[model samples]
Target chain A: MEAFVTLDAVAVPLPLPNIDTDQIIPARYLSRPREVNHADFLFHDARRVPATDEQNPEFPLNREAWREAKIIVAGKNFACGSSREAAVWALFDAGFRCAIAPSFGDIFRNNGTKNGLLPVVLPAEVVEDILAQLEASPGAHIHVDLPKQEVTAPDGSTHGFEIDPFAKHCMLNGLDDFGVTAAYEDDIAAFERRYGRENRI
Target chain B: MSEPSGPRTLFEKIWSRHRVTEREDGQTLLYVGRHLLHDGGATAFDVLRQRGLKPRAPDRIFATPDHYVSTAGRKLAEIEDPRHREMVEKLARNTAEHGIRMFGLGDPNQGIVHVMGPETGLSQPGLLIVCGDSHTSTHGAVGALAFGIGSTEVAHVLATQTLWQRKPKTMRITVDGTLGPQVTGKDVILAIIARIGAAGATGHVIEYAGSAIRGLSMEGRLTLCNMSIEAGGRAGMVAPDETTYAYLHGRPYAPQGAEWDQAVMHWRELPSDAGAVFDTEVSLDGSAIQPMVTWGNSPEDALPIDAAVPDPESAADAERRAQMRRMLDYMGLVPGTPLTDIAIDRVFIGSCTNSRIEDLRAAAAVADGRKVAEGVLAWVVPGSEPVKRQAEAEGLHEVFRRAGFEWREPGCSMCLGTNGDIARPGQRVASTSNRNFMGRQGPGARTHLLSPAMAAAAAVTGRFADVRRLVGG
Candidate 1:
């Protein structure tokens, strides 16, 4: 995992709510191995014309000015269905370092933390403001600073956010689950010695 | 701070027992009592290889092939798609190499990972279970604190057998009174999702209680918990009782003799304490819930079978109205169309949600003497090999077969459009599976989520018909 301290990049606005994991990376793409790059499949169904196989110009992601956006501004309950981690992997592979929404699906948010892709939860009004700003100026930059737990808008106004401190620690240090668990190896071994006796296996 | 008052809820008791250590940030490391894996386990294995890490306790992990395996009665070697075949083969090889117990294609225990867990007694009362599949909450029927985790968490559990977590707040959803004759667990859950919007249980673990929940069979209980994730719950639980004990006794993985007695003694005390308080509470009248079905794109877009499609103009808010309009557009449904009048192209009676023996039996009862309508195609794919064998023994397979329903092998067929078993594009289906998201069944496929009996009714009638009306109850 790469450490994420701060990111300053263009923000893309997608205001639709309840954007589920199926839409993020459909189940069809999931059959392929994890090594396969899934960015192309992100919103594959929504982005393409069913009859012509042409890219839908109306979709936000297809807009030329927003093509290089690295932060996604979305509506409430983003990534709401299925516990697919590939959703996060696809967004990361597509160069998105952060996603701002009013809320996120429980498992998808957890998956984001593990993969070093930040899911920023803001007030609905704040998210709407950001979306409006991004819509007004597609290449406007948003600054996310993990240590400060703040997001700075293009106008230089800053907004504070809350994140799980441990998650923040892990992200700052580039510590994946293995690295975090390795810190308590001795305790884990002790637990095995004590509980392994009665286990079914 | 003063000592807390009132009795602890079942969630509290289980959570405390599993807590290994608490970090300063309010996150605790909880030991996983059991870990279940499926074809997706390959990703975790790949991560392990990349990190050069060995599983801390291979014995604690169990693997199976479900998601990508073909459910067309073909042998594993005959799987046509090399990618799907590779997924199952990779899981088999990885489980074998890592010394993890695997229930492969031909194994009697092999089935949907969630079904295999409890049916095999690998899920026990008061245990913390985690699986790669979202429907893992199904094991919570046994009073376990079980929830789904991502592939990265799978790798973490493989390495440490523990997950770092922040404890979720608790909600108690109490369904009162007895269910009407035609209503099933699927109806109860759908009703709850309808009552509370999709994100109602967000950030909370739900404990289902009260008379109606208690009256359900183990299969019914599993069905209830299986859809808890649809309501955005982190986990869903029911306290262990005589029913749970009876279901587990003598199963291959359950405790034996004296140990079983001791385990039972502990489980008997696992119910929520009399005065336990929940962070949130919601209640429903079981008798009022009819055989329910989803009309729009979300699981929460549900109504009783007799209800008409809701008009977008009647929505409480603009956002909701817009959402309804989009859902209606994607489903190809008119606002006033009666749910029972909508025709379906296919009927899928399978998936982790409703592929158990009881589910199959319910569908079989509906299909016993009735012929499937001419234009409709129906399939009954059992949850596991054991479920398939049991259904065959009971002549349920013959009943379905004679009724023009396909009796297929055990896997997640037609649930999420994998393994070459998908509804054709532009087709509409009556599905017992969870989720009705666009393209969930197949690209451009419209799904009307319903119970197994209701799905069977649609199969026989060529349209959505209320199960109560079809069964003449």
Candidate 2:
């Protein structure tokens, strides 16, 4: 995992609400290992024409101006369907450092934190404003600062957001969650021994 | 663990029972009672091997190969694709290396993880369960606090047998009165999702209550809880009752002798206390819910069978109208067409949601003595080996075959189209799976979600027919 402090990059807007994980990375590609670069699988179906296997020019990611976007502005309940972590890996592997939505699927938000990608939740109106600004300026850059918990729009407007403190700490430092939980192994083993006697499973 | 002072909901009782410690940052470490795994979880094992970590509690873990296994037969050779075959073999090798119990192919207990968990009595009341797949909530029907986790969390549970968590708020959905005939638990859940949008239960664990919910059999409750993720719920659970006990009484892994009595006593106290409060309350009239079928890409796009495809012009706002138009275009549906008039190219009656014997019986009853319509293909894939055996003994397979429906082996076939059991592109399907997302069946495949009986009706009629009409509600 890479440490996150601040990033300034071009952002693209995907205005569809309830965009699910199946749309992010279809289930067919799920069997592949994490070592595989998942950027090719991200939106594999939606990025092509269904009838002819041709590149879909209408999709935002396919547009010339948004091809290098590092941030995604989406509608409510983004990534709302499955708990597949591959969805986050696809986005992160695609060079997206941040995702801004009015709300998000709980599991997706958790998955995002573990990876290097930052999931930023803002008010619906604020997200709409940022999306509109990005759409008006296709190559506009939106600035995200993790320590300040703020997002700066292209139009020079700033908005504040909230994240769990522990999550924030992990994001600020590129800490492996396994190491952190392993530190409490003693306490966990003690609890298990006592619980085993009481539950008698 | 110290008992908290105050009345508690079912979720609270389980959460406190599993709590090991809490940090000031609101992250609590909860002990996992059971860790279920499937073929898709092979990467998690690779992560563990890479880190040189052993499973903290191998005895508490169980696994089965479902996601990528072929439904044509119970052999590795049956899985033609090398990528899919490697995944199934890896699960067996990984479980063997770790000394964890895996119901691999050819085992009588082999099946989808969710169905195999409850059927084998590995899932019980007041337990904390986690799985890598999102449909792990299906175990919550037994009164356990089960939810899906990501790959990293899967690795976390395997290494430490503990996970960090923030407690979710509780929502109680009460469906009062008795459900009318032909209105199955699948319909009730679909109705619930339609009432509350797809993300209505996000960040909340839902507790299903009231007469109608309690009346459902254990299998029905599993079906209802299975789709909690479709509504964006962290988990869904029902209070254990006589039905839950009966279902687990003599299963392979269930408690026996004195332990059985003790377990029942504990489960008896697992329901919410009288007058216990919830963060949210939602009520529905059970008798009013009709058989449902989804017309759009999202599970929340469901509508009663009698309703027509909605017109974009009637949408409440501009954004909604645009979304509706896209859905209509993708589904190849015309506005104002009666849902019953929508034709389907294929019918799939399986998946974790509706593959139990009860679901098979429902579909078999409808398909009795009726031939499938011309040009429409239908398949009945059982959920597990046990379900397949039971269905065979009851002659349900013969009924389906006699009705011109293909009877197949057990696995997740055509649900997500990962096992080479996908519909052709542009094929419209009436499916009994939980999700109806775009391309969920296959690329450019349009899926309509419905109950098993409704799917059978569609198979016979060559269109989306109302189940109530055939079953005589």
Candidate 3:
């Protein structure tokens, strides 16, 4: 779980807005064992026809540019509905290191931060600029340097994204909920010893 | 950092008693007393298997299968989606493999997990409960500490009988006075959310107390807790009483004669001491609550059953005004349109939230002498096979069928668009289920959350209407 927090590539061209958990990974995949390869389940249904057995030929991911794209630029309200952590597991496992959106679902945002996924909130027009760059030059990448607190898309364009200070502090240090608690484990022990079992429900 | 607080709400009482200790960060390591299981638990089971672990407290675990499968007609084995069918079969097989107690498919004790917990007494006061489903908090009605967890956290509980959590602040909601006849527990919860606004209880656990809540049946209390998330609280709970004790007297998991005596003594001690404390206190009058309806994408976007859609211009808050305008446009509801004037294409009276035998009986009471509107596609699904069988024996199913409502299999059908039973886009559906979020039913579909009785009456009238009209007529 060690994290570099160093800037990697970024895809400025955002994906469609209001991306739902089901669209990230269909509900059918929810029944599978969590250890199963959930990454493959992402966009499984959207790639295929709703009523028919055929796959959509022009879906974005089907395009060559997105074959190995690790950074996803998405529209507003991404990761909305159902606090399924598998949604985060899928995006993280799929090699997506960062997601830039105007707005994000509360649960998904919290889960993303806890799981080491950096979520960058930027204005819509700023995101559209990156999309234009990606569209103009396929396979374009943006640098999202966590330590530097900056993002540089492939076209050498610079953008400043907002990250909650508390969350940023945790991700760069690879601290999970327990890891954070361990910092105060000594204080917790001292309190318990002093209070005896009165506090133990 | 403690709130300007005094006199613990039931939530504070449980939190202080359960608190192992607060760590340096905003995290708490409290002991979990019980963990309920359900059909949608296969993912957690898989995680446990991968880690070579089993449930640490076998006695504390409970399970049922009412999702991704069904029990009305020949639905036990007939599954349209192979994915859903396999999930149910796997859940049943794995529960057996784990040697954990299970109310599996066809078991009379089996039903919606939340519905059966209170009925059978598994959900008791002063206990901590967790499950793989978000609605698990519905068990908090017995003054228990209950909340949902991710599969990973579920695995942590299975392996160690505990979970790593950041304790939320406590909010005390005092609901006094008696409710109006039409203001059921569902209405009470809706009304609370409407007043508090959607995110009012963010980062908090709610303690519900008052004569109004105490008077609700175990089934109704579960309904109240089930929708706590709609208010952004981690969970909601009610203290135990004679009704709680009576509900748990003789059930499969409840303690045996001597053990039961000891357990009840402890459960009795679960209430807040005369002088405890809470972080925040909010009081409301239940008598003022009315049958309510959600008119927007979020649950908070609601009004009393008799009220008209609000005009955005009348909103004092800018964000609320924008949201109101958006809701009006999306729902195709004019600002001044009366809620009763809205037409509905479908009526669904079943889900984990509602659809218990009691819920069914309530709906049937409204459906007794009426027939479903010809244009309405109405369906009644019991929470479990046992509920369906019981309702059939009591002729509740017949009552619905006679009224032209289709009595279908038990899986989580329209509650989520999971099992292939979804309303078409643009159709308005009155659902006795949770979550009326956009596209929650199906793409472009509109959903109105209501009680089973309300759903039944709506089915007959082909619009959102009051159930008391049919019930009292």
User: Which candidate has the highest lDDT of all?
Assistant: 2
Q: Sort by DockQ, best first: what order?
A: 2, 1, 3
lDDT of each: 0.89, 0.92, 0.73
DockQ, structure candidate 3: 0.19
Residues A1-201 of candidate 2: C-alpha lDDT, one tens digit per residue = 888999999999998889999999999999989999999999999889988888899899999899899999999899988889999999999999899999898899999999988999999889988989999989899999999999999999999999988889999998868978878888998999998876654
> What docking tier does model 1 reach?
medium
Every candidate's TM-score, chain A alone: 0.94, 0.97, 0.84
> TM-score of B chain for each model?
0.98, 0.99, 0.92
Error of 1 at A32 (Å): 3.0
In what order do the candidates fall by lDDT, top score first? 2, 1, 3
The alpha-carbon lDDT assigned to residue B60 of candidate 2 equals 92
Q: Give candidate 3's whole-model lDDT.
A: 0.73
In the range B1-473, model 2's lDDT, one tens digit per residue, is 45767889999999999999988888999999999999998878888989999898999999999889888888899899999999999999999999999999999999989999999999999999999988988999999999999998899899999999988899999999999888899999999999998889998999999999999999889999999998889899999999999999989889999899999999999999987899999999999999999999999999999999999999887767988999899999999999988989999999999999999999999999898999999999999999999999999999999999999888888999888899988899999999999889999899999999999999999999987788786
Off by over 4 Å in 3: A1-29, A32-81, A93-110, A118-201, B1-8, B16-22, B71-76, B311-330
Q: If both were scored by lDDT, which would come out higher, candidate 2 or candidate 3?
A: 2
lDDT of 2 at A120: 96
Q: After superposition, how far is residue B310 of candidate 3 from its true place, in Å?
A: 3.8
